[model samples]
Target: MTLPTTEDRDPQSIGLSAKPDEEVLAHILQRQIVALEAARDAMPQIAGAAAALHAAAASGGKIGYAGAGSAGLTALTDCLELPGTFGFPADRMRILYAGGAKNLMTLAGVHEDDSEAGFKDFQESGLGSRDVLIAVSASGTTPYTLSAVQAANDAGTETIGIANNADTPLLREATHAVLLKTPAEVIAGSTRLGAASAQKAALNMMSTLVALRLGHAVRGHMVNLVADNEKLRLRAQRILQDLTGCTPDDAAIALQNAGGRVKTAALMLLKNLDVDTADRTLALHDGNLRPFL
Candidate 1:
């Protein structure tokens, strides 16, 4: 039987068990570099997916991520970080794991094949044409992930699929397929290594680009980050100080006047506007700071 590329054994690791520690580490590092290169080659597809996601966000639609096993965990991490990293609204995001949210803490492998569960989760979540769903599966044939894609399609949702194989069902079914096409893992079928690395890189590209398109990022800085903690509050102050030629103390005052909103505070400092005017300006500009600068 012909094995999938992800399942094939790598010749470099044939004697991995007997190799020295440094040599084994080097071998794994080499494969990781290859995985990153594969992901880089897929950037065109990732950019397209980002554009689709930006459209969905503009329409007030939620972004959903669905997957199984390691891929699911990676997708979940990306989904959860959006709110804090780019100030993407938490309510506008959803994560569909094979066994549900609780399974995130204790991964149960059996749920990876539960298609009915996938269908039901998407149904209950109310995914529709306005929403964008990103489905990830290293094998590109996980029944749970495919079922989620099918559900999203049935609801007229834009679906972006990320997989480590070519011509697989996950890629074939998705509206935009991002194929990483990385080589086999050092540990053979244990896809959590190389496959997961490629998937992570692809997702990072897609979500970060989407954030840039959404105006959450400005000049390589996260202008819309929520300053709910001390470290972030300090960072917000620094952002305003650097951008507006204000002292840290002045930035702190601006932050307070803007009610702890980093974007609004920066707007106030840069435009020399009062809190109310800066807030209004941000709202008028759709939360983007580039035009004001």
Candidate 2:
């Protein structure tokens, strides 16, 4: 039987270990570039998925991510950061990893084959017609990931499948398929390299587009980011200053008055409104700041 492209041995792997350190590093970097290019090639699919997610979020729905192994880690990373990065609520996100938290540290390969666990986990996530689920698998054949997508489909949730290989079950089953056609791994079947890179890049693009569509991002600024930390608070102030052309002190005061909401603070400064009015106006526009800006 012919191996999938993701499992094929790359010619570049020949003599890789025997090569000079610089040559080995260069080959790895080159393959990463190839993987990123594959992600770029899937931009249309990613955008479609992002549109679905944005609609879901707008309607007060959840976004769920499912995967296994390195792909699962990538999905988890993206899921965990949405709240802080775009002010998306943590409770509105779900993660359906194969083994739950039991194998998170080890990521045992056995869990990837547990289709029942995948289906059960997704079912228990409570995501339905109003929600979106994104599942990632390097080979597009991991049983766990595929099952989660299947469960999502059965639950009437929109599903997006991200995978490295072409024409596999996960891709076929999903509502939207993002094929990141990364080249055969230099390390031969070790998807942690190119495949994981492509998945991460594709997910990053998809989520960023969703944020933009939701009006959480403005002029490349994460205006709706949760200012929970010192660094993020400083960033919120900077965003307020840059967008509203307000002094640093004014930005600080506005942020305080707006409860550390960068978008509301900007609106307050730009429209010369009180905090309550700015908040109400933002709500009137569905939390979008573009019209006020």
Candidate 3:
């Protein structure tokens, strides 16, 4: 059964900051409790999604986040960065927003209730049993998110629903459900404030920590990053030089041998192996190039 909307929270205790003006303080006092509680409440559902995603990746499947509005934006941010930062393939992750890619930059509101659109997106992506789907909505009633979740379930893909309201419809249908517990906005019902922040935090936990647990991070660094650009190229050089005491010039050449892969370059320098050896070793051990080096 769905829980009650808002989950009956106090809007005071959430704002713990003591160093703000009266106006700001009052605003915090009026909404802090509910705002944070909203995020706190969703932890369980987020945990489920994370677990499913980790399992899916381990089994050669993918993880996807679907939503509209702020939730969709945050998911997109996480998905696009998966490759450049952690070196996951584009197919390993996806963020399906209600509006198409064209609407990502424009402020035009997507049709939140477009169930058919959600189904089509899920279908086009070939949702399957190996995948995990995360559906986000502050109100717990966005039709697009709901449709996607339902489609994922039908395809045997695990599904997690995130919402601010308790006992929400989406929650009831999803395999796992978590409530954010955010109440009406400080300005009334504007969920963009607390709800959005809560969603970001939960998503951060899912992607960043999942990456870490799955060996995407090394010594707290994005070592498996794809060094395909000027900024990332420099980052690869710095990482290589820092790890192996190589000169800038030597690091640059090593990076080339490693095909501009920071982690691979570091492995080559540290292990004193050729690029081919480093590549083979890292591929053997799930890209933990540093340890292999």
Give the best candidate by lDDT.
2
**Per-residue lDDT for 74-172 in model 3, tens only?**
667777877777777787777778977877778366567799999989998766898888888887888998999988998998887878777778889
Give the range where candidate 3 is weakest over 10 consecutive residues by summed lDDT: 2-11
- For model 1, residues 1-293, the per-residue Cα lDDT tens digits are 88999899898789888989999999899998987898889988988888998899877899999999999998998999989999889998999999987887788999999999989989987789899999999999999999999989989999999999899999999999999989989898888898899888888887788788878887778888978889999989888877778998999999988878888998888878998898898888788887876
Evaluate model 2: give its TM-score: 0.97
Model 1, runs deviating above 4 Å: none
Q: In candidate 2, which residue pairs clash? A: none
Q: What overall lDDT, based on C-alpha atoms, would model 3 receive against the true structure?
A: 0.76
Relative to the true structure, candidate 3 has a C-alpha RMSD (angstroms) of: 4.2
All candidates' TM-scores?
A: 0.97, 0.97, 0.84
- Candidate 3 regions exceeding 4 Å error are 1-22, 25-45, 105-110
Q: In candidate 1, which residue pairs clash?
A: none
Give the alpha carbon lDDT tens digit for every residue of 1-293 in model 2: 88898999998778888989999999899988887899888888888988888899999999999999999999999999898898888999999998999899888999999999998998899999999999999989999999999988988999999988899999999999999999999888999999999898888888888888889999989998767678988999889888988899999888888888888889999999998898899999999998877
Give RMSD to native, each candidate. Answer: 1.1, 1.2, 4.2
Q: How high is the lDDT of residue 80 in model 3?
A: 81
